[model samples]
Target: MNKPVILCVDDEVMILDCLKRQLKTEFRNTYVYELAENADEAMILIEELEKNKSEILVIISDWLMPGIKGDEFLIGVHQKFPDIIKILLTGQADEKAIRRANTQANMYCHLCKPWSATELIETIKSGLKTISKS
Candidate 1:
């Protein structure tokens, strides 16, 4: 069976790597980790993953990027796939962006750049609990 995916999008290579590392460390082989450097790539990756019958359970994205911003990207994703949990892990996002994400994208959580791994894992766990109950 194909494993459920956790996708992380960021413009910075290092940030993407770090997020992937942390997620892999925390979740172990529970999820298939995917990384993209921009919103466009992420959107395409999402489509491909879905086409391949892989379940994308979570998406963690950065706010500032080359093309689309995180809020806009997540909102688009939510419109198409409402069940995938969306999270913003950006230091650059302002209050307006965060509010927009919450209202439009149904974002599960927002964490700053220097995120605590424990908090991130806990947040994902809580979000997954709601999904499991439903």
Candidate 2:
């Protein structure tokens, strides 16, 4: 069986590397970590994973990207896969975008850029806790 996945999308290679390192430290071999450079790639990966009967437990997305903004991308993801937990990260957050993500995408949370590993892990844990309740 495939391990459930934690998907992360960001335009920056450094950020994607940091996220993989931080999440691997906490999750170890628990999840399959997939990274995409843009929303288009992420969407394709999502479809392929789903087609292969893999569970995508969460998605962490950067707010600013080349083609689609994080909020809009998450909204699209939610439309198709409402159960997947969505998280947004931004260096400079817009209230409207965050609010829209929260209301429209059912976002689990938004973290400011440069988040501590502990905080990021805790946020994902908290999001998973809600899934347990549901």
Candidate 3:
């Protein structure tokens, strides 16, 4: 099997770059990280990973994007790949959005914008632990 993978989605290029840097620095050998600018690309990556027999252990997505809200994207992912841990990282998602995601997407957690790198790493580690056990 391929190495564990983490898929991160955001419309902003800067955020994706930051996440890639942090993940690479913190868990250099533990994960193969992938990034997408939108949900469509993310879905394509997911399909490719599935075909390649690669386990997508975690997915972190933004809530307020140009199109296809994070909740909607996550719900789609949950329907097709429920085993992937879903996390929301957004600054503007309301409580109702979060509730909807929790119900439909089975969201693992929500981390607000301006999140500390240490906290993100901890969450990633916790998610990996859950996947490893499964």
Candidate 4:
């Protein structure tokens, strides 16, 4: 079977880099990480992954971004691929975004900014475990 892929979206390069390193260290060769700065690029990557027969297993997106908000981005993904696990990370997520994510996207979880590497890894692992069973 194909190994699962992880799609991460963030406007900041540092967060994306940290996530890549941590996920690589924790999951090792089990995942292929794809990073994008905005929703449009993320969608393009999703299409490419789909063509490669490796749909993304999870998405970790920042709640506050330049263009589309994290909730909006996840909602878009959920519209096409409902099974993909969605996680939102932000320092200042508002109530509107959270409510929208809950009602529309069915967001799996939200992590505060400056999330510990260990916690991030554990969250991803737990999410993957759930995905594995289903």
Per-residue lDDT tens digits for candidate 1, residues 1-134, read 89999999999999989888988899999999999999999999999999999999999999999989999999999999999999999999999999999999999999997999999899888988878988
**Candidate 1 local accuracy as lDDT?**
0.95
lDDT per residue (tens digit) for residues 17-132 in model 4? 99899888888887889999988889899998998899699999998888888999999999999999899988878988988998899888888988988888788788878888
> Could you give candidate 3's per-residue lDDT for residues 3-86 as a string of tens digits?
989999999999999999999999898889999999999999999999999999899999988779999999999999998999
Q: Per-model C-alpha lDDT, please?
A: 0.95, 0.95, 0.93, 0.89
Candidate with the greatest TM-score versus the true structure: 1
What is the descending TM-score order?
1, 2, 3, 4
- Model 2: pairs clashing at backbone N, Cα or C within 3 Å: none
The clash count for each model shown is 0, 0, 0, 0
TM-score of each: 0.98, 0.97, 0.95, 0.94
Q: Model 2, range 1-134, lDDT digits (tens) per residue? A: 99999999999999999999999999999999999999999999999999999999999999999999999999999999999999998886599999999999999999999888898999999988888899
